[model samples]
Target: MKKLIMSKTLIFLFVFSFINVFIKFFGGSNTLIGVTVVTAMLMFLERDLTIEPIKNTFKLLGINVFLGVLSFLAVQNIGLGVVANFTALFVVGYLFTYDLKRPMYIAFGLQYLFMVGSPVSANEFPVRLLSLAFGALCIMIPQFLVNKNKLEKSSKKIFISTSEDILTKIRNIKENKNIEEINLKIENNINSLKKMLYDNRKDEFYLNDSAIDILNMGLSLERISLILDNYYDKKMNNNASDLNNKNQEICLDIMESEIKKLKLYIEKEELIEYDINLDEIEDINLCEFYIVLNNIHDYFDEYKKRKNTKSEKLYTGNLQIPSNFKISNIHMRGLSKESIRFSYAIKVALAGAISGFIMDYFNLSEGRWIMFTIFSVIQPYSENCIIKSKKRIQGTLVGGTMIFILFSIIKDPSARGIIIVLAGYLGSYTTDYRDSMIFNTMSAIGSAAMIGSVSILFINRILFVLLGIAIGLVVNKFILPYDIKKGYKYLVDMYERVNLEMIEEINLCIKSKHNNYKMKNLLLVPGLIEDRMSLMGINDKEQKHFIKEQKHLTSSIYNLYVNIATNKIKDNDFNEMLKESNCISECEEVKDVIIDSIKNTEDIGTKVACKNLLQILNSLNNKEQKITV
Candidate 1:
């Protein structure tokens, strides 16, 4: 409840209302309108009200708004309106189309362009932009007054929490417990940590390097746990011998001790040396128990080195704006299917055009309401459209009823003003609460009712909202509807980019002379692949296989980092293997060969796994061969 009141959204509403009321008192409607223009423009520019400034906010706003006004003027040409609007949508779509990057400002511009029945008068554009720039400054003022270092501090806590969770899981494994629940918890923490890393980077905080190290460490720990789990399962087999039991106990003891040392090292922020003796452990080859132990040892050794290393200052630079914005990244997606942005742009433009035509033909008053409704309610997915449709209806009903009742009793100007203020507060406070749209709508209509003709406005608003929703539904269903395949393909395209970036970061970090070279592209390939697979469902065998290979590749990348950290890659044999390449079918083949070699007490299994790991590294670095796909 307390957090709700302090939330930036609520604060923004308060500031807007306070400024609007103040301006209304001094300069009346002209000033109030100017303030509204500024507030609305700035609010749209700010997608999430984080302290970080938008990338090229001023530049993007200038270009988009200028183009929007031009487009709006073209739309006033009776015969050319639909064609102009359609052309504007495609142009905006193409201009902003970067692979995996959504340009929300383009959408914002379209909304502004179609805001009224005609283009805002030529003279009003400059005044409105000046007001908007002032509003943007006002919004940023509070950001400076308050300390936003909480993001940095909280992110560090999240990173620490992730490490603690992993340690708990390892300790639980020692008690012979079911680790599935703990595994889920660790996964959740890791995801939260990833979000923090991105958030910190977005804020341009100095803790980015530390966050990356923590994330990498957490992933390495997870890989180590998997190794332990596999070894534990093999040792606990029904055909297990006394030799397996002895070896299992020794490995468990070694792991438990090393994990304790790791926890100590993390907590104290100091180095801790540890060693495991495979020569001392009897029958090390009986179950390949030594291999898992060796990996864990390498991980711990690497963790210590990475933790002690003081990283160089990360690159903190201003965002760049391209001189030309016409390039389309859709072709880079390497898909025959049209990009979703292109498809969605067409859907929105077509639906909006049809709505405008219907309104113009009927000679409806305030036809701008129809365009606003279509812009607000139409969505990328059918399910989203349905949900938004329900919300719109509920909001309209609440707003209309509130206005009707308020206008009947409130005749005194001063009394109505008080009511408006109170209603605004209630609406703003509950905007994020249950029936948020309803409260927001109620506030808007109720405020208008206090000063203007309520009955007509109420009826028009509700009618247009319903009409827009209906048109949006028809267009989405009959036009290019939601295509999960296309969405999956797009996600895969994004994953490929992320994968390449992650590998490149690792490559740079390894080669850099700087002791503290932070990895810039920390892509969560596993999570991304999971999302893609979920969209494709169980029927996509090729995507499934690709996801599996990618997971192995990601794990191998981390494990190779661990190997490099431990100086294991310095070994002549390992160095030679890292330089070689093999066309491996899958990680499973390598795993199978490893298991067979272990059963036969041969080095082939270990060699196969090492070769496969190197192959993934090579594939990622050399995009010419591109994962043999």
Candidate 2:
């Protein structure tokens, strides 16, 4: 909270200071203030103020600064005509290096168009660009510093806590003289470490190489824990207390040896650098095992509940639920089919053009242009977007009224300076809540002041703004509209990609000659599964059903693939087992079931096929017990 407040304060100060400097250098003009306010608001909106790694933030800052300087110099030398197109090309090229090429390219194109047609003069272009750069820097710097400090502090604490926990578990093992207790503690620690590692996946913050290396070390510790558990279990069954003592000592020795090996691996691999080897991650299938274990535990718990108690209603079986449905009175809503047809770029561009045309028709282009610009990117289906738009419109009206009254009271340059300062404060405050009204109000006041300075009537400014918002709202509701289908298609495409990748990995595992090679491939399945599940919540019933069916099939395939990979690793021929157990037939049945589920639109067919596939896969793989829940 302190960090967020500090970051906001720093940004506010930076913008205010930069505006002051600009006003000093070039007498405050309405056009200049309007440009400044717009650019500052854009920077605040675009900047990701979330806690992130210092290195990444610094890297982004350096890149943005370089790009800004390049853009400015390009405009200076090549003129606006050449720089306009080239600036877009450069932003696109930069984005290509980051795998977000498509969206960034579209953004660059729109920004290029906006810059080219903007009323701001060529003489003020450099200053405007610098203002934008300064705004970006303000947000990035404080956020970077605070996040780095917090991560460093947090990493140290987690390390100490984890180490202490491990040591305590070992001490308990030594004192209890009971292997089962020690085994359970070690398992618990492994589970905790697995959760930690999984949580860190795709995280944008905390780039601590040591913390990541320690996680890798935990994988080795897990292996040691498994070995110790096996040893203890064997000794206990044999009733060999003397042997048990020796085995416990042996377990400790083995654990020490493994820890030394892990330490050497970390040192030799230079794992402390944040560049983790994707191949190395493949070797630990801890996440996959964690999911399987968790599911099985849940299944057993439900089974126990069923066995222990009699309910008023007898077990009828699993409740059947369709993934997708449309209900009209229950506030039924879906993506506008028209909106889905166009990408975000097209939607924004169209919205801007339509809104501008409406204002132009009404002879209120200037006020409406601002409204159009704000709503262009605001998604139609989004509640947040609606809220922001309404707030922005109201803000503009209030700000315009304020500017009219203020201009009547204070005609001096110093009063204008104070108004500028107040506008800066309002702008900064808006960034904190993302309240569009405050932002719109600030822009409106700034715009009115700019127009008023040029001898335009204050009443006319207010009327123009109202006219603009009216057109903007009309365009938003009627023009193209927002659609949910696009999102559904996106989810479907992602699902397909994940399945394709899984198939590719499984094929690679099957063909690999080495024993441990397949283990790495097995590890990736869980993360892919997790990604799919996360998308499920955001989808409609039809989409959800499709995802569920895909998940069921994928899970079965993963289990089969794991069993095959394990057998190959142990240098055991599983052909006899495969043939006797009807594995091939079961695989074919599972494939057919999935294909049928995909073809059939009805919920019943899909659910039944999914259940059948799950059952067959479970029956075929005796190593993996069937989940009865």
Candidate 3:
């Protein structure tokens, strides 16, 4: 249950807060307050966006200038301002197609632009742009210091830790020491493995072979834990607290011993040599037992193949990827209604346009805050928007109340300044939406009070933010409305497509007798979709089935890759069988060829790979799980 916010928030507390304090000491105003807040957010976004320094440089300069100009133009004409908001929001939504992190930094830059963009003379335009350039510079510090490599390394480290944690759990099961609680912890660690993997994926659009190894390794760990769960449940009576069967106790003991050895092997530590044969275990269900045994040998198999393995990259297009692009991440797509980015852009742009028009026509106090609120709460899905809006409102309420109480007690400007600084730091350090808003409310009210009359700023902010939330929710529901239901089918289709592509690649690798598993970057597709579906606050049978199928499908594909590609089991015989079966339109013919070869072959690698291919084909549409000896 590690909160992702901890490390990131600590970095924000030290790096960006220092710069904010420096600005405050040198005549900071309301505009600077907005700038500092946006800069803090930008620092977080920057960490997710770029992997290299030069790419960041171009992005920082180009994005700041674009947002700065839009903001300045937004000030001159009301109609143009409405257009500016729409265009900016559209770009944010559309950029989601390119990089997952694009919308974040762009949206933060918009806020900075708006803060220094308005109610000023023409002569102030250059100065405003200059300040934004400085904001980008502030963000660059954290981005360059803590980039994707740090997290990628962190992900690898998690692999070792997950194994150790599972090792502890297995030992607990052996001792029967609060086995239920240990099971819970094991489940939590499995999820942690998933989160850590995707956290790295979300940061980069590129992935190397090592990243792919992490995903496959995680899949193996997940299967190991699940198989253990099933075996222990059947073996140990949880409800009756019944004694372990004396008949099976020895087999379980052997499992525990072997798992410990497996952990040591993954850590590259010396293993205790065993005189006994693993396959000789007298177990009722040798299926799970053999799967675990095979999994233990998997790391070594992959390692042997990886030595001469030419790492492949993602992207099948003619356009050369700018970076080395070594990592696997989400793939790009075309414009369509089903596209998350396309529909999201249209929805956000419409909301931004409406918010901007209201701000201009009514000239409501801090009306721009309404647009900001709309931007913050509105998501690709309206259901998510409602949930986010609720949290945002709760945050604003508590934050406003805190500010009123604290400011009421301390009337001295110097004393309040210290309090305000503390509040801002907490806000910057917060990763939760509700908590951040609570502290952000105090800091916002206190900072505004310093520049203007403190009379009604707190109440005005509370009301305005609420109004914005209400408006955003309504607009999201009525305009280009999308929910998890709409996206679920699309994601399922995408999942199927990616799986099919993997099967195709496996076929090609067998034929060529060379491996080219280049779909690593796009491996994030299933995980990302599953995550979003979970966030929808859904628990229906249909959604649950979808989630289950996704898990099954992805794990099957990874298993297939491990069996066929990672082991490097293919030889001239595999190519010849593949060529002989090429005339058949169906993979069933290929599966038949493989199954026949498996019965005739004594090579362990070839037999295991052929069996796995048969299983994979069986899962797809065939039921040929066995072959006569």
Top-scoring candidate (TM-score): 3
Candidate 3 has its poorest 10 consecutive residues by lDDT at 322-331
Question: Estimated TM-score per prediction?
Answer: 0.68, 0.47, 0.75
Best-fitting candidate, measured by lDDT?
3
Give per-residue CA lDDT, model 1, range 189-306, as digits (tens): 5555554444445433333444555555556555555555555455446686888666666666666676666567656656666555543444432223334334444544454464
Ranking of all predicted structures according to TM-score, beginning with the best and ending with the worst: 3, 1, 2
Candidate 2: lDDT of 480?
A: 56
> Could you tell me which residue pairs clash in candidate 1?
311-516, 594-605
lDDT of 3 at 186: 48
Task: Evaluate all candidate structures by whole-model CA lDDT and list the values in order.
Answer: 0.53, 0.42, 0.60
Report backbone clashes per prediction: 2, 11, 9
Residue 197, candidate 1: Cα error in Å is 5.1
Q: Model 3 — TM-score against the truth? A: 0.75
At residue 582, candidate 2 shows an lDDT of 31
